[model samples]
Target chain A: MMRVAEGSYAIADAVRCCSPDVVSVYPITPQTHIVEHLSQFVANGELDCEYINVDSEFSSLSSLIGASAAGARTYTSTTSQGLALMFEVLYNASGMRLPIVMTTVNRALSAPLSIWNDQQDSFGVRDSGWIQLYAENVQEVMDLTPQLYRISEDPEILTPSMVCMDGYILTHVYEPVEFLDPELVKEILPPFSPVNVLDPEDPKTFGAFADPSWFTEFRYLQYKAQERALDLIGKVDKQFEETFGRGYGGLIDTYRTDDAEILLVSLGSIVGTIKDAVDELRKEGIKVGLVKIRSYRPFPVETLKEALKDASVVAVIEKDVSVGYQSALLTDIKGALYNTSIRVPISGFAAGLGGRDVAMKQIRKIVENASRVKDEGLELETEFEIFDVNPECL
Target chain B: MQESLFAPGHRACAGCGMPIVIKLVLDAAGPNTIVASSTGCLEVTSTPFPESSWKVPWIHSLFENPASVASGIEIAFKKFGRTDINLLVIAGDGSTFDIGIGSISGMFDRGHNITYICYDNEAYMNTGVQRSGSTPIYASTTTTPIGTQSPGNLVRKKDMPAIAVAHGASYVATASIAYPVDLRRKVKRSLEIKGPAYIQINAPCITGWSYADGDTIEQAKLVVETCICPLYEYVDGELVGVKKVRNKRPVEDYLKTQGRYKHLFRAEGGDVYIANIQAIADRNAEKFGLLD
Candidate 1:
């Protein structure tokens, strides 16, 4: 498990071994340890890169966007509010096809700040053009760091990839992680060679404005080109298997979905909890399973429908809410299956926002509630049903 | 890569002052440089692909990150075994002096061999002329509209050159399209330096300033000569050279040239505000060791 180590260093070490050339980051809570450790890496000459101590998180991504576009293997780690500040540059990073990798240690956005684990941080960034992958464990975080490069820099993909891990859960907690040798990383990722470079000798221009007349076409290229990258998500994941031995999914990862009547779906580190609960439910003769989606945008539609096609009840448990409408994943998942033949009823449940624990205890409760609703054959409340909503905590 | 780095047709407004400044900057930067563009009017107008006006390889990351992005480019080139290349970060005044100050400072502090150019159009011309850090006092931008009693802006122009110099920049200079040779010479000199350098050009946007398109080059010269924005350099934080106050013209001449500043003159004329502007220009001259 995470090399039998706990604390924030595993995330930092996983990143350090990747040998990022520049990390333009500003420290925000929970995320501070990751950058602080990386800063130490730069200070000790262990990581051969420039650690840009930016003034704000806004500047952090802005700086990373600069360095990454300049053809550097750039990395940044940020939590909730810091991420919001960098929001302005997030879309530009992906739109320009700079293969910048970011690790969003999930946390709740603040006013009355809670430096605890939550999914709101990463979930808020669902629309950013960067490819999004949720790590199920520290091991996945370690593997996914280098794997992101493969997915993002592929000639077909040439898009940004964000490897998201739960803040306190995976970012802080330790688990089994096989540190891939540096030589292996080199063999797999090599150095970043930007499809576009800012060279003075053979000068070029970038990031020029696109007004209304051509802005849609540019967006069309982004949306259409993004799908091509989704194809490379598979291509790169396959290549990742050849080099790293452990293979990650291009979109969705399933846990015993075949012949299962009740299927549980979760993202990030909570998947492990859901998996454990599924095992406990299986021992009791209940055919419960899991569908963990890694790549959220270019949301895993076809693969999801193909994987969870047979489940009688597909429980899409979400961490963050879309405020009023369907859970973000439910909307995307429904749309994914709208044109398809799969008629599995996706029971949407919202849980674990603002660091509220979606514990294995709660996961079992949600699954049971879904099963009971289906057995009754009535409309299970379509809007998100909180498993345990208490005003005392509020 | 070819001679026509700037294509003839662009979506720039008919009387846009940006193209002239860009042509001059690119000419100074020459064809071989790679550009790190901050999101701005220049980038938006010049690069509406499948038709790019760029002859050289240019990249637009975020609006306020060109300096940082240039740093990344410098690091990338050095790390990937590239040498003898120049990285130019071209951003608007709004991007440079305001939103991107921290990133620019970080780049300067890191001591990268990059040149950054802030095309000082005095305000945020891209997102519709809003007030910016570089917007002069008493100017009417969308954010800082002039009214009775109080003049538009109470604050003076931000001291960006002083800030860049404070950050251990090897070379810092002010240049305008009005002087191509000096701009080229400064670009060439700044090119030889092995650390971050700052060059802020006095580019006036006719669209925002309510001036004639053909007045673009002339107004730029006016900014330098009138001493409203004197062109000077500070090396190791010491005054090196001033862009010269050739027949130092009255601030009124420069002010009268643009509609944005027309309010500063008022219905019968705001003599008090005019005097205050004169004082700012005088302070600039003596502060930079310009005219005796």
Candidate 2:
């Protein structure tokens, strides 16, 4: 059915279709409406589950951990400080191998306390061992959420998953989205039966103390599970496409990058604007392209290499800076291209931080900057340039 | 087969009072129960690797979220369509009175039907007897040591049961391992309530209190008899069971048995600290009507 809906409501509807047995949440901006709609669904008898209005983000994640351990499908949502408060239990949920799914609405961290869109909050904890997937629009947010439960609950990869969408950019925007039939979702995602749970009839101890002799082995298993997710992601996406007839480009998507001299790389809603800029630049016969990455954690190294292998110069644009070094995604790209012989000058631009608008003009400025670096044989003055930085006296 | 959900042959200090409280709680909760514990002496001592002292399902994660964890299990079972499984959370006093207070208070306010038991040993016994919120005033601890110019701790014990009641818990009670029947009855009664229930047991630490191995129960009994730790239960914001003291003992009788309070008797101007301690006990007796 083609219907207009906000991205948060679309995710809420998708979550309802998955029949999560428990939904625990504490309201945070940009993520509030997702849980609010679910609460209404539970209240109006549209959904049959336990809806808990936990006191804080800490308790929300903690309660989900318990519920997930007791063999119930669980869901939650948060952004910025809410996600920061849940930082400790995020590792606990994954290390215990509970198949809990969460929606992380991307927002900037606080000191100045700006309730704005940025990728710093999620990127800061990229090493926390969650399968992180970024969504570009309302349709992608609706379509990609249901596949998370199936991917997370696979016995080979019993890890938690985070479906991150840009805060207000994606969550508050309305778009025409086609929701899959509830019956189809039921057929695709089977009932959740965990391999290990807290059952009194068959008692077992979870979160036991692992001493020096065995602690590393447990971490090794967690590492192995993440390693397995790379393949599992492809299989799940293929099965989803086969059943639903719509497939997101499995790991990374490309637009007109087959024979381009310059390429732009980014993720989330910013990719849409960058793609438009790429098209406008290409009309003038400039050999430029765009590669939008969807999955950042199980990073698609081979896919990135294949897409940008022929480009003369590559530019990475992101909303977060790593303070003393380049942006996180740019550092990751450098690492991925380390051993490969595809040596092209890759420059990074930091834009749209703290909810500042990343207009098409700024994106064009980024493209021109990359073009100047390529044409004049110039090295990047800094690791990455802060786009639209204010001058001293201006 | 003996019917104890918390099994035996685990590691704990000799005359440690926590296992007695655990056994009483499990006996009252029966076999159809799940236990969620926090990081503390009981957890570290009970479930160390390949051997477990738990015959029931047990989980121990971080130190400050057992109540939140139990809330998860309780709701999960509710969704699973099985309401017969009793969920119990057990944590030490440090977890209950200090680091975990926010999580536990949230659990109580949300009105989940779970029992949270805090074994109050008055200090962080597992971490070498450091001071905690539940540590009594002027008691010697590793963190609040006795010096020439300084007595032990400068604050009074945090009134956790009162805090629980303030959160509108369906049931709140203070029990001691000194009286098994009273403790068991409170646990059973608390499990009957339909919302969050809290039972704080004053389980004196043998090593931390610097008491003889055989005097755990005697010390616990003295605490109640002297009105230092009154035994009482509250049901739905009403006081129901306030144990009366037939012959009230002085605070010195309870204070002299432990080394934590030994500093008061040995140090100069220590009589002032003892008078303050006596006043606190008198206040407890008056507030709870223990003299009646």
Candidate 1 displacement at residue B181 in angstroms: 3.9
- DockQ, every prediction: 0.53, 0.77
- By summed lDDT, which 10 consecutive residues of candidate 1 chain B come out lowest? B1-10
Q: Write the per-residue lDDT of candidate 1 for residues A345-389, one digit (tens) a residue.
A: 777877887778777788888777778755754274443565478
Model 2 misplaced stretches (Cα beyond 4 Å): A376-382
Q: Could you tell me the lDDT of residue A309 within candidate 1? A: 80
Superposing every Cα of model 1 onto the true structure, what RMSD results? 3.2
Error of 2 at B136 (Å): 0.7
Candidate 1 residue-wise lDDT at A224:
77
Best by lDDT: 2
Give the per-residue lDDT digits (tens) of candidate 2, residues B138-179: 999999999987899999999899999999999999998888
TM-score of each: 0.90, 0.97
Residue B273 error, candidate 1, Å? 1.7
Question: Model 2, residue A390: displacement in angstroms?
Answer: 1.6
